[model samples]
Target: MRSFDSTGVMEQNISKWELDTPALCVDLDALESNLATLQQTVIRNGIASRPHAKTHKTPAIARMQLESGSVGICTAKVGEAVAMYEHGIEQILMTTINATPFKIERAMNLRRWCPGFVQATDTPGNARALSEAAQAAGLVADVVVDIDTGGHRTGITAGQPALALAQLVDQLPGLRLRGMLCYDGGAQHVRGFETRRARTLETLAPATETFDLLQRSGLNTEIFSGGGTGTYNIDHETRGLTDIQVGSYVFMDAQYLAIGGATDDDVYSDFETSLTVLTTVLNAQYEGRVTTDAGAKACTINQPWPIVKGETGMTYSSGSDEFGTLRYDDPSRTYQLGDKLEVIVSHCDPVVNLYDQMYAVRGDRVEAVWKIAARGMST
Candidate 1:
């Protein structure tokens, strides 16, 4: 299926494009709208938008984000950074901790390949390892001290632990202590705006205070990065965040919609539901029940069940490994076999990792296809 450009005129030629059922499909119109909304919002608020690439896992989308005035991109792993760099993304911050020597060597190589490559670590040992690796490579590695705000994840707690780590990073010969990294994963899904704001401040305030302390200690705190699709607006409004690392806003999922961001309205429309699982009705068993080709394998079961778009009074239930059951109370409005349906995934990031390629669609036509190049680049 072929779609026309923004002109709306149908093309006479249709390519022989066939996508397997239960594959991921991205609506191009919705995707572009989502990107524009986030880019505009970040710029309007005077904050640098460095969207995380771990969501889309596509270099094409990353290039678009950079073109939209994003300062850089963030990845969760070294392999992801390498893949993005190979795809022409220059500045990247590996948000996760990299302590292994092999990983440090790889990071140093990446820095040599790409002019701007940064990594975060919370301990002095890892910082020293990175410094040694960079020294061996005859280059300086940009490092950020990861701070534990409230997530209790991989980061040093504020106050003594954080200060000590920052001081050590500064003392290291081949490491440049860039700034502090703190991400409140827990605040991303807080339902109420006030509640989310309160939680974000509660966590981020301490981290910001730690950054202030680092600056007071004569260390430059250049970049204070954190935030996601759920908390981008809140973090932008917050005082100390210089960069917002949002990723899922480009292809919103059902889980983010349930987060109840700044408004009580349907959050799905805030950013269009660009990512979807395209399924075909395979079984029409019973009176009011139908089965689709996509099951747990196609859609992520990480959050609550996915919602069927534009289909009211319909509930989706998992059916084994290769099928999903959709039940509707009204028997008269039943779907027949071979009918196509678009399913909204619960978590866009992980669900996107499940696919190999994403079909870009406009209306009912396919315009382009993007590869999930870094889908399994977890290392």
Candidate 2:
């Protein structure tokens, strides 16, 4: 279906290639496998998963993750968490700092309704603001101090500063300090297994030290939440890590694949590439090159360009808004004007935001079509 609504498309043996151009297709088998693999790893390591919903932006997928043993979910924005909360996702962690009056008010509303909602904050001003609003609402807001592990992103500095923030959050009225968030976003794509592991350990060291400081200070250090799919296997060894916030494991993309894992020297194969932007060849007029309907608007234009599934020696460029140009050196396969191809996106999150629904396909059969309910919910 060209349109996003696939109401009657469920339970049909429809060829994925037959779906409309630039359709988002997910291999259910791969999806299931990825979920199981991560769950198994976390369970075995005595850690829990708080999968980030910002990647899929689907409540159905969030529910699936919870059912697969995820303790809760994480959303980067107030709007995304609100969208998820409306759809029966009770347990959520809003990972970004909600500072503005409007955002804090909206967050308090969500906190009032969902008991499991947790907010992450770094600065004292935001903590005081959240406390003031929460106290006005007559409820205690659950919050975590965001600790900047190494990425130097939005988080308070580790060591005494993190502990101080936690202490401040603890003393703030109408606020319950749950734990610390130490996400090193930069370490998640370090390109080599040994190199990444070293960087991850080095970066997370300060956070672990700060976790100790929080614990020694008699604060609730129960939840030391952080870690991505890249460092999932490595982060379990962290001194205070309780759960990992792995989002992209559900839909491995080109950026993740290039990072290289422990077993694979040049590619991170811990998870399979399940999500793909399905594109149809629109023009085959030129030799050694073809144009597809999925361009920057469809598949995204990130580096390590889209990988043509099941085909080798094919380079894809979606520099244009309307078409992705594909060039192949040798003819392993010939393409017709209508031939459909799937490409593992360079980045899954933004690519997902561009779509309206994802077709859950098992081989050539369509089992379900999950709406991109929170698509463009970024605020």
Candidate 3:
């Protein structure tokens, strides 16, 4: 009954079973295997691997990925980058655009914290702002031009417009154009292997053209970084991409599983589902319905329903902000009060952001408690 404790008062070295319910758990063995596989795959393809820290948001895991041969780590925000720096991660790429005065200043300071710090830009105004801020801070901020690549997110058109932005950054005094970044987020989840591969290739065409344009304009950048777990294999085979900035491959979720692999025959099982939510059945008085403690606040609501580990004939439904309802097809299999259940999260990113710490478990024992360093670091 004492699950979901964030008081920071729990004793150290507690067994996994002894912990309270509704806890965030990471399988240490599975995590290590995922890290090793990603690094090995990237190395086999001869491309730099920079795992995105925004997914795990734990410095311990970031360090493991780096130690496993990742070129660097990618952060989604300046605050996340700061957290990584506090944990002694020296090389970081802030993969989002920062334009506001305070955010630009914070990003500039982060550059000072990590010598290899880099940020992305898609507009000339933002580029100028970054250049001015870096100049005022007495630093030359490394920058990457962000290509839209059909995501319709915060990026410029990949070909001429992206090259134009790179040119502007080059002309700016305190901004150094490191390379171009084209992350096809939608292509990463295109379901079938051939469709995902074809979509990823088509989306990156403009990025390739932009890279070539930059070279012809006498402004060849050093790196072409952008990729996700969904398009890791596709990006690895793409010639112009220098580094694959993948995040979710480390602790895959239901969404990634549904994306399937290049063969179109199986889920992208290159990595294991190392992360999970351990919930406790709080109520089971109903005939075929049970309720657990994990809700939107715990496991995130953006993804599909969480999968009940090793169980069939049951479906998890959203109940309240702090609870989930389980509907079972097998009425005979009734759950009792205080019964614990393990669920693979629907989405790993926001689910990780909801917890302050995660228990690294091996079998039934807790191996370590890793702090979520960048939980609320949205800025």
Candidate 4:
């Protein structure tokens, strides 16, 4: 609505820097490359890509992921799945366990309409509750047993505990046991590639054994899904890994980039940094220091503070509520009022949750504005 284009992009020839300050942006070229790179890599390695939607939380981007050969998209919240479902995104795996009375009702309501919906469970009680709700609704719910691969965030233990849960899911009325989610989320952020690889395999060893246990027990073990951006290349090395739930690869940030890449390059060069925050310098009174409009509210406070794109020796800080501190020891260039700079964010997921929409841009041109439709879908 702001500029001139039939497709809702800004006026022709308007650069991305011309956009409003503190805006979230997706560099379309880098994004497409990232998508194609990850999709091609995972597919070639005989692994399926079921990317997580909680990163961008945009249905448009989810559709892109699906088109790029992602088997489905993963969502951390039930409402995020519901939103994607409403957008006609069929292949969805609800990665979070929801057993609350109202949440169960909501999941059932969604299951009634979403044939591609698959839910995750970690505990026996939650699994039982889900089956009961599914049975009452005359629908059989599909689910994955979330095996905690050292994340300790959710899921049952490996070996006996995990196998028992899978067995229970198999026998439950109105429930179909899809497989297990052995996501080693904790290992994904390990700094060195080899170190991360070792941690992932060591963490996943028992979980893979559990997968074998499920198969030996004659239960459905079709989907042994779990992996993240940091461990995508390394995950396929493990046996029975059906898919890697790679999320942030589509729009990398400072946190992921800091983790060394496959060749141990000290920067995760496997994926490009496609997501960014566009901010304008609001004040430049102090030498070697400038204030930007992107503060904690815009960029979020996860370090190593947001990196000023293409400019080394420049540091960014979102210390203030509405202004960011740009500090430099020596001069690369002088900053002036209203000068725009793009900085890669520390974390992409929660920062995305703060924005209403993100502008997709090609070099010097706005391509589209995608709404973060599930921005605050905490449930």
Candidate 5:
């Protein structure tokens, strides 16, 4: 193992153990397994995967996904799409609605660099704005109509409203309606398999009906996209979905496992838990508790405290900005100061966004480090 010098520079090539604590680490083997499983699953179902890149936000992983037979990638924001495009990912679907003038202009500018860039809209006003902006830029922007398939986050209600918006987009001068985007984000974590499946179907009904109405009206819907990690398999059961936009499958988390779609081996439906936060115990003065160097700032506190990897009796709790308290029932087991512990984050998305880079490791060896290129693209 290489040691950090007085200036905090390593003398030799760094291994996983030699790297600083509280680091974001990706198990390369598990990551490869997850990527392959998703590719195989989508291919076996005769559907295409446009994996949401908002989870990892790393272009290296996105390129790997594309190489693994993914049709495209989906991003949560226009800025994220631009970042990905700058990394050489051309086929990107900006899932979030870019309505504001600045964002719309940014999307159009992004399309200039990557012509296959597409944006989503849930309202006719936004569609018109996109059209006008794209026209002013002398570029036709490909657009998708986002249907409120139960998340109620940022989409318009599916049905006549959806059909009307599609009609409006078709009439718009510089926007081409690519298809519909229906995502039941809440249905992705329904706990039981049957309940999750039924909930997904029930919630997707409105979007399916809207698609039917649009098709009957002679509207060309080239792609019908939407699906998350929890419902990726179930999404294929539906005839209306042409592309599944699963993201978290690339890196399973405690929140995802709580949704209950894992296989018999406890894997998250064949997707392995590749991403983990490596923390070192800094304080062991307490009798029943120990402290690590990761907390709400490092790992997400939005869900539950991260699971202490491989320690069933140990429970983690939030400490201050840069610490985590761990409690254990087994008094026999003692946590020594400087001991390393890997924690499975409760939520993978925001946790990944917290770090600048992730160390890709194969066992104890650090293979490479990939930058989280779209870390703070909140636009």
Candidate 6:
């Protein structure tokens, strides 16, 4: 392996070190376990796992998933796809719709570089825009029609409109109709397994019907893509889905754990919590309370309050923008200042996006620092 010297040049000399607290950390063992577990699950169910790279946003993790037998990766933006392509990721599915000329040009550029680029479009106009751009670039772009599977986010109605989009792809020059892309973002954290399964079936029905309609209309619906960490297993069992695009399973969060879908035994035996926010107890004030360095700025607080790992009888509370208050009902139990603590973020994706790098840790040592390459690439 190559090493860097004190002058910051690759000299094969110096040892690397870790920074301070309030940094996002990945448990190497847990992360590898998470990747292997998801890959095995998808393979066992006979589905292609194309994990969404929007979770980690790092090419290194994407490579891990790809090496673990993931068919490809999904991104929410063209810039992310370009980054992944530059990093030698050939196959990519841009999950969002790109309608404007500027974004279409970017998509075409990516297709030029990586011929395996695929995108999802919901409207005929968007499809036309992409087709025109790709035709000008002299490259064929693979396209999937996005269907609104109860998320109400960015997909078209999953019936005639979906079929129309597929037809548009078939007729449009420089565009190939690959399949359908429908995501039920609402099912990611549904409380109970039965409830999630029921909602998933309800959400997937229209999309599946649309695929069937397209097939019947002589359009080959080759790919039916959707699913997330919370509902991968359920989506895998769905009849028409040909591929799974789960992201957060690589980095389990507090919200995913709080979700009551799978039984406790099922969760424990299945996915491992691979991500955590390492914080230090900044202050020990108020007999039963302590404050940590990580708060809203370090971790995402949108879903619910975070949980302190293995700190029984202690509940986490938001102190301020930069402090997290920990409370214990037992007056006898106390946490002192400068105590290192691991916090499970309520939401993993947004929390990971907040940091610039993730420290991959093994036991007590920091092994690697992976840059969050796609962080803040919203445009």
Tens digit of per-residue lDDT, candidate 4, span 303-364? 87898988877788997889999998665666899899999999999899999889888986
Candidate 1 ranges beyond 4 A from true positions: 1-18, 265-269, 331-333
Candidate 5 on 1-379: residue-level lDDT in tens?
A: 8866574322223677777878899998999998888888888998899999999999999999999899999999988998999999999998899878998898899998898898899987888888889899998889889999866898989899999999999889998889889888898777877778888888888888988998999987888999889988888877778889999888898888776763532334557888999898999988889999998899967666788777777788754788898997864456889988888898899999998888888988888888899999888
For every model in order, what is the number of clashing pairs? Answer: 0, 0, 2, 0, 0, 0
Q: Pick the candidate with the highest TM-score.
A: 2
TM-score of each: 0.92, 0.96, 0.95, 0.96, 0.94, 0.92
Once superposed on the true structure, which residue ranges of model 5 sit more than 4 Å away at CA?
1-13, 262-269, 331-333
Better of 1 and 2 by TM-score: 2
Candidate 1 per-residue lDDT, tens place, 179-208, comes to 988898888878777888888888888888
Cα lDDT tens digits, model 3, 1-379, are 7778576634547777677867999998999998888877888888989989999999999999889999899999999999999989989988899979999999888888678899999898999999899999999999999889886887998777887889999999998888888788788778888888888888888888888899889895688898888878778767678889889888888888887775554677778999989889999998888999988888777667898877888888654798988998864356799888888888899889998999999987887888999999998
Candidate no. 2 TM-score: 0.96
Better of 1 and 4 by TM-score: 4
TM-score of 4: 0.96
Query: Of the candidates numbered 1 and 5, which has the greater lDDT value?
Result: 5
Q: Evaluate all candidate structures by whole-model CA lDDT and list the values in order.
A: 0.83, 0.91, 0.86, 0.89, 0.86, 0.82
Worst 10 residues of 4 by lDDT: 4-13
lDDT of 6 by residue, 1-379 (tens): 7766454222121122234678788888999998888877887898889999998999999999999889899999998898888888888999998878898898888888887899989887888888888889988999988999866888999899888878888999999989888888988888778888888888898988898899899996888999888788888777779889898888887778866646662242357787888888888966777888898888856667777776667888654789888888754356788778787878888888898888877775777778778888886
The order of the candidates by lDDT, greatest first, is 2, 4, 5, 3, 1, 6
Candidate 5: worst-modelled 10 consecutive residues by lDDT? 5-14
Backbone clashes in candidate 6 total 0
As for TM-score, the candidate ahead, 2 or 3, is 2
| Over 4 Å off, model 4 | 1-13
